[model samples]
Target: MNNEVNGDGPDSCGIRILGETRDLTVVNNRIGNAPKGQQHIGILIGEKSDRIELRENELSGNLDRKIEDRREEKLWPVQIRR
Candidate 1:
């Protein structure tokens, strides 16, 4: 699937696909910023998903309140591969 978010305002996420039951592919997307008053993420991949690939995309400016969350642990201004 193709996911993209382009704006100055904060957004919850560019794409959030939870409980995906099949193989998935995410390519050429841009995710950034979190909502106001609440810390959110640019992209969130739940534990239920498997065989997922994130390629040729941009993720930045994620505001995560919870330091323990995985989204909070990232290398900003660059692509993170897992």
Candidate 2:
């Protein structure tokens, strides 16, 4: 599946994960566009989220952030493997 979000505001992204999400896995996906002065985000992992796995995914050209994590945990709970 293809996910796309076009906005020039905060929290605008291809994928937005909020609240208490755990044990989530994203694999083999193409996210966002190649930056050409456009502000975009590949994914937004918000507060109270944990244990997210990103594997074999192509996230490119997000001028803002490829992965933005806003969790309040002491340690980052994202595992990325490519």
lDDT of 2 by residue, 1-82 (tens): 2344466675567778887888899999888765443446778888888889999988776447899888877365699999
For candidate 1, the TM-score is 0.52
lDDT of 1 by residue, 1-82 (tens): 2334434343344565566323667787655554443325556555455555667766655445211123322222223353
Write down the lDDT of every candidate, Cα atoms only. Answer: 0.47, 0.75
TM-scores of the candidates in the order shown: 0.52, 0.78
lDDT of 2: 0.75
TM-score computed on alpha carbons, candidate 2? 0.78
What does the lDDT read for residue 57 in candidate 2?
Answer: 87
Runs of candidate 1 exceeding 4 Å displacement: 1-11, 34-39, 65-82
At residue 62, what lDDT does model 2 achieve? 47
Alpha carbon lDDT of residue 49, candidate 2? 83
Best by lDDT: 2
